[model samples]
Target chain A: MIQKGMSVIVKTVTKITLGFILLYAVYISLNGHTGPGGGFAGGVIVALSFVHIMLVFGKEMALKRLRSYVLRGLTCAGALIFLYAATVKFSGGCVPFGAFLEKSVSCRLFNSEITLPFCEMLIIGAGLFAIFVALVLLSKSDRYDSE
Target chain B: MIEIHLILLFMIAAAIVAVEARDLLSSVVAIGSVGIGLSLAFLILKAPDLAIMQLVVEIMSLVILVRATMRQDLPFSMSGRWVFNTFSTVLFMCVFLGAAYIALKNIPLGGGDFGIASGVYLREAIPATGAKNVVAAITSNYRLMDTLGEVAAIFTAVVGVMAIARRVGRPR
Candidate 1:
């Protein structure tokens, strides 16, 4: 039988690792427009972090941490957010809407650096949330089989 | 040139492994890896968007194939007559050689001044649409209807998955 103390240590390590991964995911998502990484890359990384957490701490624990309904809601919300953003442009008499969302800002949040386009954040969020939902569903199914 | 030759060698190795492997799961994984490697080559060749699309589609295909295979036993390999094998090899070689010749001779060397129009549009797309990613600009602006259709297809796929998962009986 596995010792309680060893399991605790493992759990602690896993939590730290997951925390770092989440931070990195956010960094990648935000900096995607200016670098090699973007929505898809960041989203995959986020999903991988969840997968790691699930593997380390059983599906039940992971599910408790990240509820299925919340994930589903986030997935739908992301898509809706993206569509809403597009529609906002569409209603402005802009032909082939979502045309003006990509402009580079003169100054971004941190200092005077040029900020990436606004739609990038929506794309990143949508992609990340979608993958998160898929991973949750897949992990839950695996858990169901195990049970 | 070296990368191309390396990719060709890798492709040949994957093909042989896929043919000779006894386990269907291993074969599928091997094919999937080959698809990933091919997509990597496409990225190295300056087609990042195509590479991303190829990777996503290939992974989805692999997932679907694995799920399907999980429902049944893999078929046993069958040996063919020597003449048939010979003919198949010859036909494959001829096709490969023909394709290689055409690719080497006809295809453009690089993207070649294709960014000018896109750059001009990029400058305007951001101010007009408020989106930052140029790719997103092209996707939602130049191809809004197409983007909508793609989203609809994805929604349909999600519904299909839900329906299949909710089915009463497991497939035999």
Candidate 2:
């Protein structure tokens, strides 16, 4: 089993800042359609936040919290979500993509005039997080065996 | 403009340092700095969306690099073939860069070719998609196929990583 986390100071700081990091990631993902950030950016942020948990709390802790299957599911789900959102004709075939939402002037009530959903960002973030975690876990196992 | 120039020079220096660093960790850190500098340059150039993406990508990649390289005390291997490989790579890079420079120097930048497309996007974006941010609109609305394709590619790569890692790590 992989043991040994970092020092107390590092752990304390990670505990404090980890939640904020995740929250910020969510904000970025949700606001992607209307702001400077987007699905790619938010997804990466979310992955990094999980990585931070691993760095501070040890791999075992991180792995226990999240397993490989979950990530695999997430990655596939994210792609599926994107496919559904992108390929769908939207709202009973009112229009197709690349000009799909161009005619709708009334969606401003919810997204400040932004029509993009949060699903894409969430999936991208989840998939990326899972991939990073998988790689880290793999490397850790390699190190353990070598030792 | 001068600030951008200074940042670009610093980025170049950082790239050199990253390439030349003795240790893996230092090299990773240096590369991360280069990413940060590039993001700042993007911000200054009025591409805030790109800047944000750059910042997140840099940090995540840095994390991955640090994680991947932390285990071994990897010295710069002085194998005989290493020197030859390095020399050839440098030569190839120089020739490619020279060609690129010649081509870039002759091309007039502002020919107003794609402006019409961008103009249509700007005018129709808010009306159609409700995206206040034009960049966001372009991503999810204007050119969704590109985004879908890119995301699919990344997902495939990640799945591959998961599979390889699992195969390597499992106990026989």
Q: Each candidate: what lDDT? A: 0.55, 0.73
Worst 10 residues of 2 chain B by lDDT: B69-78
**Runs in model 2 lying further than 4 Å from the true structure:** A1-3, A89-117, A140-142, A145-147, B73-76, B102-108, B167-172
- Highest-scoring model, lDDT: 2
TM-score for each candidate, following the candidate numbering: 0.59, 0.83
Interface RMSD of each: 6.4, 2.4
Displacement of residue B115 (Cα, Å) in model 2 is 2.1
TM-score of chain A of each: 0.60, 0.70
Residues A1-147 of candidate 2 have per-residue lDDT tens digits of: 344678999999998988898888778876877678877787788888888787778867877888767766766766665565555523422334426454343223223222234555556667777767666656655456535
